[model samples]
Target: MPKIRQVEIKSCRLETYSSKICVPLPAQNLPELLSVAQKLKELTPDLIEWRADYFSASDPKEIIAALEKLRAVIGDLPLIFTYRDYAEGGFVNLNLELRAAIIESVLKTGLIDLVDLEWQTKVQVREQLLQVARENKVSVILSYHDFQQTPANESIINILKAQQEAGADLAKIAVMPQQRYDVLRFMETVLYFNTHYAEIPVVAISMSPLGMISRMAGSLFGSAITFAVYGKESAPGQIPIEKLRPLLNLMSSP
Candidate 1:
């Protein structure tokens, strides 16, 4: 298998790789965000993702204020700031310049531990954002989502490779599954990529109920992170962090 990079972030004891459980905090506005943040503090997720696209605030300053509040509440837990794209199931289809401006503003605050940037973002825009993230020392996750159906094996592997080549700290790919076999296929593709060519850790998911097994057992297949929910799932197939912890522990043991 390709070796893990062994990078460490002191805030959350996060390594460059391994099966770390992450729960998405999907509150719509500042007040509700604080409520969910408090609830998440009592949970055991290794990482927390603030799904900013679900948030209703439009002004960049308000968004940054919300992030600052979230950081204060979460303490040292690693935080992922993600304003998912509308095409990839985000709440709104913000125009390119507006989206970049907001994300860049958040990065400048230096509160977020990681930022999820879509792979399909316009080339110049994506590169500029990547540079901003680097300047702030915020790790980048270049992500691709196929909400419709999982692509062929070659295509899946290709996307992962491209992400690593493009300079992602962690490469993530999430695809939908129509049949039971698609779940296995998705996991197998991740396994092949990690064992053969991966230089960076990967977050692989087979979205929806059919792919839930991948969330529980994906550590074995080389997925470095899994997304779960405390109460509401940010994605279609996410289960509760309470249940995911026990299951993940069981599967990871000797």
Candidate 2:
């Protein structure tokens, strides 16, 4: 089969989202996962994400089944498997073995195109996970989230650089901006990195109403992708993908 062509999002890292607004189907059961994917497909989202920690069964067999069902509906559009753990603002607290098992299983099949791994996982564990993903042609988005406060611009930039050095295809950082200055700092980091680092895509977002501008301004600063909710939200400051679609489209237009 011919490789499916991706959109050319030039101003930033990539161009053109499938234009299908993605909804978060944060469900655990296979049936529930598939149901949400189908709904998002009907709604015409360009992609779908399986918040894997929400899966009803963390067992390998059941997880693979759920993923396969999701891939069926997503077709060629990108699919992201986000197994967010509690330490990083997710609900899952599975042991490293289980976490690694799930990640390896998913990537081994190449069913999902992107995997969301936390930036602070053990180095050995992360190295192994990245190896499996790279071998399987999957991209890793090393993500960091701080609900309390935003880090300094230099720290944020360092975080992105760390992820890239750790073999990530992209670097994503989200924090709570306490004031307008915090927001400005985050934007500056994004803009500077976007202009200086053309090889890697950086996603810099703030997790509050004030941070909404970061999401809206992602393309301008060279963010490869931005997270938006479909039916349910997995994080703070996530605009509905429906609303985000037009916002990004308008931003992309000269």
Candidate 3:
């Protein structure tokens, strides 16, 4: 299996299973976003992800303006563009095609380092997204999210395997654990995928309060990228970057 070639952004090198600490920027106002961006620059997060769905509008002009501001402040740091749809637990109201167009425009700017493409999208849409990202040299993170009950262990592992085969630089699976057993099952899949499939880096996480430990302990089992909120959390159980930074660092230590 093919793996993501080690790549460097700013000074961060993604080698093997290095942890990427991302701070989600979810401001609803553009001007307010700039202030938050400045703060994020000060923190110098490993990656900055924009929940474009949080914006008041999804127009290309608005997207361009936002990316430009991020590029200006972020310099060469990596940025991940994600406008999650309502069905997939996002606030965006546009049709899927319009969303894809917005992402295509963002890719053309050469501003973002990666784009979070949902695994649940139509096959045609996924193909087009892969093409756009490839042409722009942006990495595509094929993501799967189950806000409901956690799927069985076999199902989760198959999803990761399928995502890797789908030409993704990284694979992300987020599930909501209903109980302690659910959390253990989620981690078991992470460990199996990480050990058996050395090519793609797997991001396995559980949501809700019961799933908090997975966020802090992911690095131990082989999760490469972990999401941390900067201002407001886009998900149910996201720990703030400030708090997550220390905890994740402690966990990553040998």
Candidate 4:
């Protein structure tokens, strides 16, 4: 890759070839969320993704309260607040409006460092949420999830470009890989894009066990972060951080 773009979140940088790991907190309630945080205090990953789609609380007030406590418990660890809707592997049937509201509310809390907003959200709503995220000084990761088979390689780059054009601080895609070649194609696409363009950080994941190598080697090809399981997994193909880290370290070693 020529010169790559960088997006900094706390101490971590989302530039090309950086191996950062994120662990998801997939707890369904405040109590569960807190307990997980306590365990994660020592075994911290680079970023903590609160998969809020799993949250039992629907009210923005309750959600914000939970975040306030989470912030206190975790101290300065950066948080990436995310709520994926059912169309994209989310937990509940939460209408888009409520989802947007909860996200906006979370951004205003000053407790989170970034928010993951799906790329397929209604155009108007997506733009509005982006604006709020900016005004609150929180970075936005414009994300897309394809539970089905991965799309063609060209389509993958197109989706990333669209996300960048839409003002994403980071652009991410997670898709299922039906065959080994699917994972290879996804990695090649990322390498090609990073070679040609110098813009926002990007994340490209190929889901399921067959696609696991893409997660482990993604950074070498320009994908910034690898999602690993902590107490639970927010997505498929994730390995426990304990196991994931050693492999990552070995790969990065001289």
For residues 79-100, could you state the per-residue lDDT of candidate 1 as single tens digits?
Answer: 8999888998898888888988
Best by TM-score: 4
Candidate 1 clash figure, as a count: 0
Error of 1 at 238 (Å): 0.3
Which pairs clash in model 4?
Answer: none
Can you write out model 2's per-residue Cα lDDT over 1-254, one digit (the tens) per residue? Answer: 11212333212223222122335668867777777787777666555667888776888878888778778876776777888877887767888788888888988996887788888888898888988888988877799889999987788778876786777776778899999998888877767765654355665778878888877776566565677787678878889877888887888777
Write model 4 residue lDDT over 1-254, tens digit each, in one string: 44657888888777767768989998999999999998887798898999888989999999999999998998888899998888899988899888998988888888999999999999999999999999999999999999999999889889988998999998998999988988988889888887886387888888999999977886578778899998677788998999999988887677
Candidate 3 achieves a global lDDT of: 0.83
Clashing pairs in 1: none
Ten-residue region with minimum lDDT total, candidate 4 = 1-10
Error (Å) of candidate 1 at residue 248 is 0.2
Q: Please give each candidate's TM-score.
A: 0.96, 0.88, 0.94, 0.97
Q: Per-residue CA lDDT of candidate 3, range 10-107, in tens?
A: 56665445677888888888887888988998888888888888988779987789779877987877888998978888886789889989988988
Please give the CA lDDT of all the candidate structures: 0.87, 0.73, 0.83, 0.88
Give the higher-lDDT candidate: 2 or 3: 3
